[model samples]
Target: MSNSTSETVSFFILGAYLNIGYLRYLYFMITAMLYIVIVVANTSLIVVICVNRSLHEPMYLFLCSLFVNELYGSTGLFPFLLVQILSDIHTVSAPLCFLQIFCLYTYGGVEFSNLAVMSYDRYLAICCPLQYNTRMTSHKALIFIILVWLYCFVKFLIPLSLNIRLTLCGNTINGLYCSNYLVVKLACSDTQVNNIYGVFATALSILVTVLPILFSYMRILRVCFSGSKQTRQKAVSTCTPHLVSLLNFSFGCSFEILQSRFDMSGVPCVLRIILSLYFLIIQPLMNPVMYGLQMSKLRNICKHVLCYKLLAGGRNTVTESCEI
Candidate 1:
């Protein structure tokens, strides 16, 4: 890369061609298993939502959208990495690399946009209860969903385009996937504009996603504070998932920025692995855990449906015995 031998190194997911050691292979297998479990569980949750007609409410709809985004995002990283690690082929072409970045951004970005949309929905639902039905109509929900994807589509391209023709120079990324920081580090050209634009991108993340969630909670807090103890507890229960997820997301990303600013770029690989693990596993894990466990309605409905399925199976068995 120093122009001595004109050799260029490419950064691809390191899962492929791992170090020649048993421990490294063990790490790869561990991640692979975790990735597979996440994909299956999240995919099943999404399927359950789609198949169950009772979960047609706006709130669940938002959660389903989020789960869908997670499905896409998870597919981009883990499955691909698992394959690379197992097969020992880490090389990815430029187009495939860009595609990976695009897919990840689209998947994750849409989820962020959808969170804001969900927050606004909550605002309207709680703030103007009487008008909730009319305001969040099927037509309106459809329009809003359309807008979320559009906004995400545009927002994703902002960072991606900022790196236009900006080569990664001599470094293949260290991480398992294509990322803004991973890709940008290799550019030999003046990257100030991209960095400044990155600040704007970070601001967009905070302004559009983080701030709205805060605003939603702030409003929820005011409402809950004025209500009875039961009402306060209910509001807290309803908002806890959002709060947890927001903290996970905000803290992870903000740490990245703070660390980078301090010239502390050599963050341990394990930390990065933890951050990645949170999204790949923890976020998906939270969906069913919070919604099914915390919400009385979801729990009740699940119980009823499960009971029905078991009863039906029993009845069918009885009929078969009688026929025999």
Candidate 2:
């Protein structure tokens, strides 16, 4: 393919999709259900947090932001996957592909940034209980949330811009989605600039997000060790969910990075597909369920809401029966 060919390339062929025949419909149904669950679960938690004045603390606000990101990321991927799964031709238009890349990439960036901020919030609430109120107010928490999102979206635009200018030698992507790394690999032109910038951006993102998490946890750990039993219990209650979420997301991302960057030909196609999607699929589903169950206040509120709705429906049914 000539340099001019890249400009003319309008769409990309996703080569990794296996011919599962009629089973594709089964996959579609399953994916559709999972998307529904993710949306409802995350949205419910967000609504609960927003509506309940008692839960309007900085930590809950951060949780709300995290849930919103889950919704954003799941929406980006699940719809595209549903369409591609049922279609015989697994191709995505160049423009749509790039857009998906932007959404997914920014989603991941915001997720890490949100988690880091949440860790810092936990640190403040635990280590500096008295100053926590003055230090991390709801207004400041909102500002942090806004900044995390804005920073990720703006920061990722650099790479997206770089990606769009590449002279592609190929149009086939090996995975279910358009990956920046995979797309860059198809470029016939020198990707030295892209590669260099990629390394820089990735390193910067990791450092910016990871360093705060480490520092926050270190201080939290210190407090837990020297403080009273009540202090340790408080730290454990709050930090456990965050720690689980962080580790789960990090594990999925690690596998995705490995699959994208290295040769995964030895892995089974079925297993590879599952692993590639693990982060996107699992994190959104897991976060709300884990948080809803683990956080006593949120859990109690959710139960109250559900019970009220159920009772109201039952009363409406009884009233209709009497009228009839």
Task: Please report the candidate that would top lDDT against the real structure.
Answer: 2
Native-referenced Cα lDDT, model 1: 0.68
Worst 10 residues of 1 by lDDT: 1-10
> Mind giving the per-residue lDDT tens digits that candidate 1 earns over 196-242?
88788878778887788778878877888787787677667776776
Error of 1 at 281 (Å): 3.1
For model 1, the superposed segments whose C-alpha errors exceed 4 Å read 1-20, 23-29, 87-89, 255-269, 311-324
Model-by-model lDDT, in order? Answer: 0.68, 0.94
Candidate 2 CA-lDDT value = 0.94
Clashing residue pairs in candidate 2 are none
C-alpha root-mean-square deviation, each candidate? 3.5, 1.5
lDDT of 2 by residue, 1-324 (tens): 333465657899999998999999899999999999999999999999989899998889999999999999999999999999999999999999999999999999999999999999999999999999999999999999999999999999998999898878789899999898899888888888888988898799879899999999999999999999999999999999999999999999999999999999999988899889999999999999999999999999999999999999999999999999
Q: Return the lDDT, model 2, position 8.
A: 57
TM-score, each model? Answer: 0.82, 0.97
